[model samples]
Target chain A: MEADELLVLVAAGDQKAFEDLYGLVSGPVFGLVRRVVRDPAQSEEVAQEVLLELWRSAARYDPGRGTALAWVLTLAHRRAVDRVRSARAAGERELRMARRANGPAFDQVAEEVEAGLEREWVRRCLDRLTALQRQSVTLAYYDGYTYREVAERLSLPLGTVKTRMRDGLTRLRDCLGGVA
Target chain B: MTGFFRRGDLHSLAAPYALDALEPPEHKRFEKHLKRCDSCPAEVRALREDAVRLAWSTAAPAPAALRDRVLTAVRTTPQEPAPVRPEPLPRARPERSPSRGRRSPFAPFLIPLASTTAAAALVVAALFGVQASRAQDELAQERAQAREIAHVLAAPDARSTAGRDAEGQGIAVVASASRRAAVVTGSGLGTPAGERVHQLWLMRPEGKPRSLGLLAGDTPLVATGLGTNAISLAVTIEPAGGSPQPTTAPVVQLALKSVGFGE
Candidate 1:
């Protein structure tokens, strides 16, 4: 069954279906959380929380609303962003940024290898966006920066950044038509 | 669709909002705007589809042990109860029989009301109780109103559209044609200037606009009979008691789309 059907069963408190859902979604959930949170242990904790939340709020999932994968990823992304926005991560963010600036070869190698074919598709779509649009989209989604923070980072007007984010996503939506 | 106010300004935030890039205040503000935006939900849904692909692109295998921990937690966690979709309301005339089966969610606070007069009486009592500072009864009325709002929101066919005044104050209507009702909520309307009040009007395909009610601060107004040919919803400033007709031009006017009722 598709993820949508699995989610419906999960909503009915089907444990076996949930196990299947975990198999389908855990990698993307953990990977997205890890990208934003960056700490291995913390990412694990957040990912666990997200997975638990899916089981807890499964019934609220409306099949008419959108695809189940989209729903699950939204929950994962929001939770990851919430973690980075919290007070504890305020200090860790600078450290993560410093680490990112140094661009450790090991992390880069691991990321490139693990990213797989999905990353190739996203990278191609992303390349179609203007340089500023790509930067705005990435800094916010991957870095968990607020739009204002993105504007400051990019040295662009807040309005300009907001438009770019909207335009960029619209372009991506068109380019990746029907993929989700 | 007005030009200078940049009315679409807040609507443009749907992308950032979908990406989870908005900070708390902007996040809250945009969320309020989103509920009433007709095009926004679909737009946000599409963008989210793309956003998830971004999440998928970075997919890394989770630790094998983490699965055991999550499954263990799931075994003990109770799932939220799914929303109860109320039985189809007994069909009543769209305009005259406003309150018949509509209070299904509030049946505990109120008996299943049938007569329009009795429901009207409860509304009057609910209003007078508020004025008389009767706490317990007022509480019940508030709960009923809240549930009524929730009922419309939870309706499977609920559709939202939003409009803003020239000064940027916004109003959004979430209407469910099947329920023949709509909930109107606004942000930044601010308090009407001394003794004046904000009034709601539902314009039909023909005839003068009908007064829905007076806006009570931030409280959402639940108006029924959306199945009627109500073409647009307008808000205008009026005298404290409200006008028989709009005394002033509408500050916010959202054109209503035909929400098809499922027979």
Candidate 2:
């Protein structure tokens, strides 16, 4: 079913519509959110919230934005960032995050999101970033970090981190289009 | 990185800074520039689109059970699409309809919480009157209240953000598209002291901060209006109710814009 029709059904409480929407958009939503969140178990939980949020907010979906996929992806991004920001601020959550950063969930997420031209392109562009730049931008843009936090985390000058992020994103933007 | 600036560059590249794609003082500096720069505003839009695109880049696989979970959640929960309006009962039913339970002489007292809803309505009326009296405003000095009301009564922000409140404690709250948006109660906020209430401000990049509303003591602050088009929610310690504007500095500033909603 088309995203619009499925959304209408979702508004009407059609579980089938939700399932269909999930099948269609979940991968991108999950993948994008996972990159920022970086914890597989928590990623799954947040992704679930994002999907459920879509179901609940189906009535709010307007076709003008893009596709149902794009809409869900936006929500996923915001939620992923919120999770990271809160966890970091809470202090304890960051400790937990660091401990789990290298857990099996990352592998699982990689397995789930590893394909397609766009993904391949993003992966390639992401690879071109220096280790610190990649980590900072991934955390700052993808994870919603304040520059101060990203700088502190990487133990780099706030200025250096900022330049890395700007340059890194500019490269990604140019790679993706004439535009980030 | 500095080499990118060699080719007639003068920090014009700071437009993507909204995505935190730029660094500190420059980030602060460009923010000042964003207000007067129309071209930069358009550039900000492009950068935001890019950010949104990056968000959609690799699709992550949702849990297998997500299908079941979401479907089951939607299925089991009743959708009150419109408030259920029961069709007029098949006019003139027998007094003792067997399907609905045997009618007895004591049926008068057994209102079943529905029959006397009309009489019980007095309770609702009284409740509304009290709420109206409490929530009603007496301050005639407030300006253009209608437009402001629209901004305030908007559905309590449905979106949520993770950040720290003024006290630097963890908080999750949603800001409206503007400071006047109706705020649905979230899990944060407590009463501040006399000369110290929760002051809401819409912090524009370079412009003087516009005051949204206040979270006073006792009354639930959830429904208060937030600054719309607000980049961040800054709560300050001002006099009871709130300052005509912020008198002291912001105690907490949560940048909801970074979460990409404002984008």
Candidate 3:
């Protein structure tokens, strides 16, 4: 069954369907959170939280909103971003950045991403963006930087960073052919 | 993040918001914008789909035994009840439906509690600069006010607008039509000269203006029971204990657009 179908069953409290849904989604959830959060142990904790949230909020899923997969991933991404932005993690993030000489936050994580067809397609789409646009999106999404932080890290003006983020996502949306 | 984004260009924040790239304050502010911007929800949904694709591009497998940890925990975890959807309105208007059990009017706003807590902490920290030596009672009162400010900013239907007072002090208003509440914060507002106070009023299209309350310097002022007909927020100087109505012309009048109905 598709994830949408399984999610509906999960909403109805079918344990088996939830197991199936987890099997289908856990990889992407863990990967996405890990990409943003960086630390493996912390990533696992956040991934578990996202999965539990999915279980707890299954009934809140609205098919009219977007796909079940998109909803799940959005929850995961938001959770990861929140983790990175929290006060506790802020100090650790600073240390990590200093150690890495403040390079684009994606280098290590990007290399380790599984070479799946989806990964290749996304990379191709991302490659089409201008350097500044790609940097703006990745630094924010993958590295979990706020757009303002992205601007400061890139030494670009706030307005320019905001524009690049919007334009980058717009181009990516068109290039990805409207995934929803 | 509050005063920097022009009201006309808030829709531009949609993409960053969808990608989870905004700071909490900006995130809350943008969310309030989203509720009244008719086309924004669809735009955000589509952009989020794109973001989800970016998530999928990095699908590394989870640890082998972690699956059991998660599945086992799920067995004991009770699920949350789905939110009750409000009946569809014929036109855009403030939406109010309980997401869970009926909440008391004074209960802390609960839906976005985590982010609101963080934002409120920031507000409290900002207050600490000038309020550190204040009495404990005043500290408690200010904390509550900070929470109220955070609540209004964090409301799902909150919308923000900014204007300048006569002295060029920046005034920001974040209003939630669903909650019938608004929070007014100003930068560089001057203390009124002897025996007078700065006052806030909610200006309605037809009725007499309703007093919100006295504004003390730059402390955020929260006003509840905002009428749907409220057209703008006005601030004026009133004699000491505040007045039944404004005796002076508004030094700052911010037109409140995009509160509930689409612009």
How well does each candidate superpose onto the true structure, as a TM-score? Answer: 0.56, 0.44, 0.57
Per DockQ, the best of the predicted structures is 1
Pairs that clash in candidate 1? none
Per-residue CA lDDT of candidate 2, range B23-109, in tens? Answer: 444444555455445455444434544555466555555667866776677665655352233211111111222111111223122
lDDT of 1 by residue, A82-145 (tens): 8988833456445344333222112442453354333544666677778888878888888788
Predictions in order: lDDT: 0.66, 0.50, 0.68
By lDDT, the best candidate is: 3
Give chain A TM for each model in order.
Answer: 0.86, 0.69, 0.88
lDDT (tens digit, per residue) of candidate 1 on B69-104: 999988898997765641111100121211111223
lDDT of 3 by residue, A32-122 (tens): 9999888888999999999988888787776545456677888898888888878335465452544242333445666676624345446
lDDT of 3 at B53: 67
TM-score sort, best first: 3, 1, 2
- Best TM-score goes to which candidate? 3
Q: Rank the models by lDDT, top first.
A: 3, 1, 2
DockQ of each: 0.23, 0.14, 0.20
lDDT of 2 at B112: 33
